[model samples]
Target: MRVVFLGLAVPNMNEYHNMFTELVVEFRNNGHDIMVVAPTYDEKVFGMQVEDGIPTLRVPTLELFGVGKIQKGLATLLLPYQYKRALKKSKIDLNFDLVMMPTPPITLVNVASWLKRKYGSKMYLILRDIFPQNALDLGMMNPKGLAYTYFRKKEKEMYFASDYIGCMSPGNIDYVIRHNPEQNANKLHLLPNWAWLQPNLGQQEIIKIKDQYGLLDKFIVVFGGNIGKPQKMENIVALAKSCTTNKDIFFLIIGGGNEKEYLDRMILREDLSNVRVKDFLSREEFFKVLQIADVGLISLSENFTIPNIPSKSLVYFNARVPILASVDLNTDFGTHLEAIGAGLWAEAGKTKKLKEKLMYLYNNPEKRKKMGENGYQYFKNNLLASMAYENIISRVTNT
Candidate 1:
């Protein structure tokens, strides 16, 4: 079988996980031909398509919005057309059996819908993030306006266009069916956001990496992902400030975001030595360090319940590191962590509680290590990327 995986996510590989490569590997291993169509804002991304020996063809890029809502909106409004142009650019001399699309820019569904209609492909919606509803929930977009209505309508179309759909979690299922009740529930599958960090690197090996990086002396609490507004990181920053006296504790933030510069400035103004900021590292470097890091710092804005699950926590598990998740309690994310003993505080994401939780892990290595052990077991049972491969094969093959 030939698979046409459509999404703009691959070339910007730093922004995505190893799921593309993992699936690519599994498909090729099973003797299926894989073709990926990834769009970009630049010519090409290096180091893509290196895994699985699967070939990829990149499409067109989007224009950068210097900085404004209107300019960004215009860029988004034009994306369905851009996706169509990219679709036309793909050199698929051979036909495809399945159309796999990811989201964030939900308009990718239009391309999938087009492929299914014109070429008779089976469309599979691999939902990574849910959409303008996420933005609106986070207070980024007005919920009661024409803009909201337009996005809500498009969101429904994306949901409806998929012949079968897979999501990162049941929380996502709740969101989808709540909005698009007409979609067949049996067609929906919980395709968990997968963790790809192979764990043969044991505690001794990971400890050596930490020692080499001079990170062994500190109780490292690492937050490694997009440092943006939805992070609601002012509270996180304030907690970092509060931990200034705890010289043995360190805060490592690794990722770029719209608000990263502001986060950097806050660190500078506050003269935070315990807190260090680094641009996102390569997967190997990032996970190697995480494997030794004492704790994972997972967070979501209290209001952002729909579109995000912040797949980063899976890394902490794969690395056998405990987590400190700061999401709303009502959400499944918090509940999942609580159920698995991955470590979370009941108090709201207040500065006091944040600092308190950090200190708890910092002072109690034994307890932290136990939480990490629990996480490793949880990852083995649930979040491995290979599980996703089997699930996809089963769904596409209808086995």
Candidate 2:
């Protein structure tokens, strides 16, 4: 089968940890041809850097992030069609069997519809984050009369265009169903997260990374991902300040974000040594450093109602490091933690709760280890890439 993975992220700084890569690899290994068309600016490649070893296309895009709201919105409109044309031109010998897609930009829906009309192609919507609604919840979208109606219509058009839709968790499915009750259930399948096998170097990798980061002797809790508004770093910063008395515990945050410069400024203004912030580390360094982390932080802003089941939590779990979340326990994430016994959760914006949870995890190595092991088990049984691929294969083959 031939496939085109439609993405609205850059080639790098895509925090899904080569999520599309892993799926493409599986399909390729199984004698399928796969291609990816994504929005990536050469200057702003975060984790979604242009990866090698795959048939890929980089469509010039109107960049998102930072203070440029107008340009970003304009870019989202053109991105979908730009991606489709790029693929159509490049893979002249091949046409996509399925266009697997996700978005902050809903243009792909129209692109898929174009493909369907032009070549009878089917679209698989990987609803990673529900736009407009998620954006509305995040206070990004202006939910006023005209703008609301226009964007809402676009959202439905995108959904209606998709032949099959996939969501990361049941909560996400529920949210979608809540919005579009008439949509077919069989079309809205659960798209699980995935895990990668870690290279086993025991404590030596940790010791080495610690030494390199000048954190060898410190109890470091790593929040290694984008430091965007979504992460709500203010809460974590408060937690770092609270831990100043602990002396041995340090908050190590490593990743790039539109908010990276702001975080840098915050660190300086607060005069914090307990919180060591690093820009996006290289992929090789990122993986190696994670192996040494004592704990990983999974966060989403509180008051965020757009259903989010973070994929990074499973990555931390697969690395055998427990997760420390700053998200509301009322969500599916907290339920997942309790269900798998993977880690602890705190209210999204509560600095006191974050501090308390971090301290407790630091003191309980046995529990942390147990949670890590449990997370790995859960990843194997549930979130591995193979599971999602199986679902894709079943649908693609109609078997």
| Local distance difference test scores for all models | 0.74, 0.75
Per-candidate TM-score against the hidden true structure: 0.88, 0.90
Worst 10 residues of 2 by lDDT: 43-52
Off by over 4 Å in 1: 12-17, 44-52, 63-72, 89-91, 200-214, 346-348
Candidate achieving the largest TM-score: 2
lDDT of 2 by residue, 18-99 (tens): 7767776677667877766676666443222245455567766666665475687777767766666666666454456777
Q: Candidate 2's C-alpha lDDT?
A: 0.75
Total clashing residue pairs per candidate?
1, 11
73-146 per-residue lDDT for model 1 (tens digits) = 77667776775665565434535788787776776777778877888988888887777877887777888888
TM-score, predicted candidate 2 vs. hidden true structure: 0.90
